[model samples]
Target: MTFANVGTLGTKPGKRDEVVAILTRRNPQLESAGCLLYEVGTNDDEPDTVFVAELWTSAEAHQASLSLDTVREAIAEAMPLLSGQMGGDRFTVAGSPLRG
Candidate 1:
């Protein structure tokens, strides 16, 4: 089943942009690493937050992505910018932009 993992990152007062930059650069690599869809977004109402949306071919593929060198590096770089606990919701794909 397709795995949809959506998450939000709350960064330190001035660190949101940097966190987003790192994630933005890494997103394309995720697609190369078996992610069916990958996106990084921000919320205007929440300036310190970065939103992540990902679609993987399977749960294993999502797990494998965490082990990828580039992904590991990105995580390390983004970790310090995190100011609060990461929050997320997982879903099974019943409908999506990719379904067509």
Candidate 2:
């Protein structure tokens, strides 16, 4: 089943851009690992928040991605810029009009 992860990360004040950059950086490894889509967004009304939407081939693929060295490094780099607050949702996709 297609796996989806949609979440928000609370960054330190004035650090949302930095966190977004980290999340959006090019990483071909993600595609190789079964990532279908990975997007990062931000809300002007919530300057400290960074939003992420990810689609993966399977839940296991997403979980395995966490152990990737590049992913781990990016997380480490972004950690200091975060406020330690985070929220999000994960689920198996039921259906999507955009999919065939």
Count the clashes in each prediction.
0, 0
Give the whole-model CA lDDT for all candidates, comma-separated. 0.87, 0.95
Off by over 4 Å in 2: none
lDDT of 2 by residue, 1-100 (tens): 8999999999999999999888889999999999999999988999999999999999999999999999999999999999999899999999999877
Model 2: how far is 87 from its true place, Å? Answer: 0.7
**Candidate 1 residues 1-100, lDDT tens each?**
8889999988998899999899878356677777988889998899999999988988788999999888899999999999976899998888758457
RMSD of each: 1.8, 0.6
Of the candidates shown, which would achieve the greatest lDDT relative to the real structure? 2
> Which consecutive 10 residues in model 2 have the weakest lDDT in total?
91-100
lDDT, candidate 2, at 76: 98
